[model samples]
Target: MIVPSSLFASGTESWRGDGRTDEFDSVATASRALADGGVTAVTGAFGFDPSGTAALIAPERFARGTRSGASRPLPAVVSSALTPSDVHTDRIRRVLAAIDEGVVDKAVLARTLEMTFDGPLDPADVFARFLPGPDAATTTAFAVPLDPAPGRADHWLIGASPELLIAKTGRTVTCHPFAGTTPRGVDAESDRRAVAALRASDKDLREHAFVVEQIVDVLAPLCRELDVPDRPQIESTPAVWHLATPIRGVLTDESITALDLAALTSPTPAVCGTPRAAAARLIDEVEGSRDFYAGAVGWCDAAGDGRWMVSIRCLELDAAGTGVTTWAGGGIVAGSDPAAEVAETEAKFRTVLGALGVDPADLTDRSRPAPAPTST
Candidate 1:
């Protein structure tokens, strides 16, 4: 697990062995484990669907350190996307229709790309490639081992995420949600223009407001005092620029753990959509199971202090270690352009594809018209 301030690596045995069973109350289970005094911290990942299974663990041993820049070259690989670009864009159009119909104000849609390596890929090495500098206060890189399906090899979820789902410390609660996005420009001048354009775009601003408003509504009842900026600021990563709003609150009930806050506020408009249930239903009909793609990952201590980062800019490695599936998504609103949305997901994919020595440009051909939508 990794946060901007620290990196933690854990091994040995989990307090209750593999904790990835079908639908259980993970937050409640962790609370009980912490209350029992068997472990100081509970770490792992929560799936995208709140009711879905989670891969949580109470580690027996763990080490903490600062972030590192170490990395190794990835081997040769073949890549394919699970969802075709045309199909994904067509889905975006469908979401636009939903927004027009007032089904939801906004929704996040994602696509996945799978890569198979020529040899076994080392999780540690791939993770190393994902780590950011210690000064990268806006980024979090993580590598969490997941429970394998019966008869399958060990699997892992790994990525460098730029959005914080939630963090808690003492009576303090914080969430930094990222919404509207634009690809980084090719030159310094173009980049500056891109930032300026993003800050002023009405469409982007509307998209961002949906995320901030939803988060504030969820957190308001739980906190005695909450601070939300009047406007979002530009948050830059190597691949894209995002409009981010940092929200902080003082909890009225210190008993509320980070996991609880996460459960309440996650799948925010940044990852899900406004009127979450309506958007989620639309997503399920189109994208099927998200697995853990847009889920949250982190550790919460017995003191109810911990951090969770949105599971974007991430990939899942199969048991054999050769197959990898990474996902990227964008929020869709009434003004969203289908072509631009497709490009946005592409820009998001660059965070991982570039690291793996893959040229993202070669992955999609835009000259041809996107094909009509079909069942997956």
Candidate 2:
């Protein structure tokens, strides 16, 4: 179930599933469910591949609100072990080769870490470490039930994502897509310099622009009035800083729900790459599969008004929550450096690593210096 920190105190019920809902039919179906005055949680996989899933689930019960604090600190030994493929720079070289061959202008490359903790694991505990009593407002923290069907192991998808895939409230809609990134510094001066470098870097700016342009192009036809900033603003999470642009518009057709917008704009250039189809093919050959890591996760109300965020900075826990797999990736454009990309994935891993009670340095130690910490 997706439990947003702010809504945790509001007695909001939630649900989850490993299935697909018709993007075209979901809004109307959800509107019917909401006619009775209850909200439903919609969880989707990154859905880059044809077999990915999505669902609109009803909450079984919404317990009275309570303030559950962070979980106990896990032992340091319960850290994620890097795999040979986790720091593999060769995959990036291949992606760059595709860029050189003009197969795609930009493609996002990702890596994974496998974590097995001692003793039983709790999804709430992991969530608490990342969210921390609702004070961590920079990012939206969530936990979605992974398997709601009977005869299945209980599972949940949890994460704290900084990007908003789509938001709908009546006729107005908003999207915040992040593209370029840089690691935050340990001090004020260093942090400022990191932000400046991201803004000034031609490569980063170009990457960021591609994402903004992609979102604008898709949304323009559906909106009566659209607004996009000329430049991106800096948005931060405890993990990294992003070059973000906030786009807003009044939907020309109120019939288009948030879910429809998500289907239309997902696997965006920010997460996929320019010329989405070609990038997806390359990602498949290189990264294999991404279950829900880059997918959309959030709740949609009965009225079809809801919020969904890109699935990043997250972990896919086993049904029992014992084994955890998390992903981190970066965009590859012309002039990209393979070694630097490896470092970028390492930096992105820090958010989930810290949440899981593992030291970031331990993971970073295995790779080349992590590119100052940027996120997908």
Candidate 3:
């Protein structure tokens, strides 16, 4: 349960609720209880075996990540080890077919394919290889474990995402945007150039625009005149630099709680897509799934305002605590290159691998090359 803001220390971040909640102590039981009690929404790890208990979850409580935000909504979770046949996968298959039929040129879809090593995965060993050093204040980047359910085994959701999803203080709301991804280079100069390229990229700019626009559109009716900027700026670090945009607005009315706002905006275009209705249809045709991969995966208070990020860089645990899945994808516009898009997925996978301490280089079977570090 969320501790009231009054319980926490006050400051510029006073809007932050008291940081009193603990990591979910019993994932499986809590998940099950939510399921049985008819909880409206639940989200945890991103790699639960869709064929297992995770798939049985109701849409709200058992929602997926990446889809947690608007601009990044991929219909399915993405990973290397997942099997390709399920209801979500089937939906993606339909979406892909439609794209093939001249419906949508670019539909973002993902998978959470998992792998088991001889040992437990560790993020410390690998995160530095990709991300290197502590970069920003209030910035967190790592491979975190997702408890499949309360009391279940730990599952890995990997990635180097360094953006805040949402934060609230009373009636005020704050959001961060992470789009326009670029890979780091072997040399410092080249790395800088890569980041520069991302900042100046038309495709990236458009992708960023789509999300920023959507946020303003969705919140205008509900918020007290948003403070979103006209253009996103280049926010960078050694590993990755994004066109970070911060959105702040006050709740226009008090009838709804924070949870109500989350329901309306948690999966904005920043994590989903532009023209959401059409994008979802295209996803069904091109990618083929709608399990919990790209849905909301954060906690909430009765007031509803809580911090939730796009469920990027995460995994869901499977039954028997062995198998797993994870999701990753990128915005595909008219100029999107299939190969580069594949590379972006590879870059995202490193966050998971680094967290698991699994060497991405160890995999030779993947169709893509070993990923160079990129800002997640």
Among the numbered candidates, top lDDT falls to: 1
lDDT of each: 0.77, 0.69, 0.49
The parts of candidate 1 lying over 4 Å away from their true place are: 1-25, 66-71, 148-153, 361-376
Off by over 4 Å in 2: 1-46, 49-51, 60-67, 75-79, 83-87, 132-138, 148-152, 361-376
Model 1 lDDT tens row, 1-376:
4222123322211112123222123556666676666676767677787556566666654445434445566777754545677788878888889889999998899887877777778766777787775556678777777662222236778888888989999999999999999999999999999999999989999999999998999999999999999999999989899999999999999988887788788788898988988888888776666777898887787788888888898888888888988888999998888898888888898989876777755553334432233432
Q: Of 2 and 3, which scores higher on lDDT?
A: 2
lDDT of 3 at 172: 85
Per-model tally of clashing residue pairs? 0, 8, 86
- How close to the true structure is residue 363 of candidate 2, measured as C-alpha lDDT? 48
Per-residue alpha-carbon lDDT of candidate 3 for residues 55-128, written as tens digits (9 for 90 to 100)? 11222221121201112211222234432334334434554455566665434556445654433333323323
Candidate achieving the largest TM-score: 1
User: Which parts of model 3 have CA positions greater than 4 angstroms off?
Assistant: 1-106, 119-134, 137-161, 237-239, 364-376
Question: Clashing pairs in model 2?
Answer: 1-144, 1-145, 19-54, 20-54, 34-302, 46-295, 183-372, 183-373
Worst 10 residues of 3 by lDDT: 5-14
lDDT of 2 by residue, 1-376 (tens): 4433222211122233323322211334444445545444443333443234543355543233444557476644354555344335777788889999999999998877776666657777776665633444336666765553222246667777778888899999999999988888889999999888888988889999999998899999989999998999988776678899999999988866676677678888888998988888788777776656787766665566767778888887777556787889999999987777777777788888887767755543244322222212
**Error in Å for residue 358 of model 1:** 1.7
